[model samples]
Target: MCAPKGAAALYVRDGLRLEPVVHGGGQEHGVRAGTENVALAVALGAAGLAADDLADGAPARIAALRDELHQRLAAAPPGCVRLNRPERKRLPNTLNVSIDDALGHELRAAAHGIAASTGSACHRGNHTPFDLARSLGALRLSLGRWSTADDIETTADAAIKSATER
Candidate 1:
């Protein structure tokens, strides 16, 4: 499912002049059929405004925390862990890594109290693996607006503990 905020922003940005494949009323400004989801639109607009307020500092802060998390996770015993993506090529606040010989879902489940996913939860564990991708077996940790250094620390500790356990 698309994030309401991101979907709305993409629409507002005219990033891609989206239009319904099937013709319909002027709903969603003709981008989508059926009546407009006014409540969700308004909420998305509000989220956009809130994100704008954090545009300057949030990314850097989150990146730092993410990097710290990566460092901790990377320090896992020997060949037990590996980052799934290049740090420079990824979004600032996302960390995707796989624990060797461990199922992503299992690892995530073991990392108690750490909110994370093994690819898309909707995929039910069917993850796609590219070159270095871990298929659906990489734990995806995303640091968001309210994530903190302490949270990263806790997550790192939990991940290490979980991966080491297997």
Candidate 2:
């Protein structure tokens, strides 16, 4: 399902030159020069249409569930659970957090019913294997159209329980 050549489009303001991040490519003003992939573009458009077909209130419902989970998890002691990217606008379907004194393994084991993942992308590839050793408290939770209130409650309970273990 991967896109061929990995197509991407950028909008640069007139007269504004955004230096190429990875120089040397003889195409698109010296970028990852490659032949156009019409099939890939069609697949991407189909995926976009599929996403747009979700229920009208699906996004709002997902956001409410995310917020509920956040509230439940953050009800712990001050400084216990910290939200990632708090100062910036975040997607309504995702909630990432780091809980103080919580081991990644501990949380994982306790949260058997929740499909939560530990460690953030920003912490990975820093010469660390999964970055779980250092980011033991981090948990990247994603809410989807199928997620329910009960799932959110269970997730929060598991996280809070694990966080309190240490």
Candidate 3:
């Protein structure tokens, strides 16, 4: 199921970048061409409302978990780890960190059941040559409404273990 609001609200332009994917009798004010998924739209709307309601307390809890994870990882050997992005100007639930001598893909692959975006592509065999991936070991971790304290602890342990392993 899909909803138009996620991509639609991201734009500042008066119109979309291109035509809709499934062209038919123009629907969704001509922004989306296919028949609307009414159930999905309703679910999206309800989730949005619930998220807005939880926004105040949710961030504080998420921030606490994120900070704890950062602190645990920071306890690793000096010069072995660094934050890829500055903490002062980021979302409370997002952490981007780089572990020296540890490739992001390798660490993530070894981290069972954990999901994150890798900023390093050192393990790529026939990779697209990107500048950042060629030199960084960044992992982008994002905690959501469902993330638990146990999850954060496990992630931090896995990351620290991966970074320290030969």
TM, every model: 0.74, 0.60, 0.70
Pitting candidate 1 against candidate 3, the one with the higher lDDT is 1
Rank order (by TM-score, best first):
1, 3, 2
lDDT of 3 by residue, 1-166 (tens): 1234542232546654666677777676665666667766566665564466376687788888888888888887666667766778778888878777777878887776788777424555654434354335778788877789899889988877766774
Clashes of each: 0, 0, 0
Can you write out model 2's per-residue Cα lDDT over 40-136, one digit (the tens) per residue? Answer: 7676655553356354666678888998898898887665777765634778788878777676667777876887777556766665544454466
The alpha-carbon RMSD values of the candidates against the true structure, listed in the order shown, are 4.2, 5.8, 5.2
Error of 1 at 129 (Å): 3.1
TM-score of 1: 0.74
For residues 23-117, write the lDDT of model 1, one tens digit per residue: 87776678656766778867765666556636667777888888888888877766667787775867887888887777888888898999898
Estimate the TM-score for candidate 3: 0.70
Instruction: Count clashing residue pairs in model 2.
Output: 0
> 1 or 3: which has the higher TM-score?
1
lDDT (0 to 1) per candidate? 0.75, 0.71, 0.71
Give the range where candidate 1 is weakest over 10 consecutive residues by summed lDDT: 1-10
lDDT of 1: 0.75
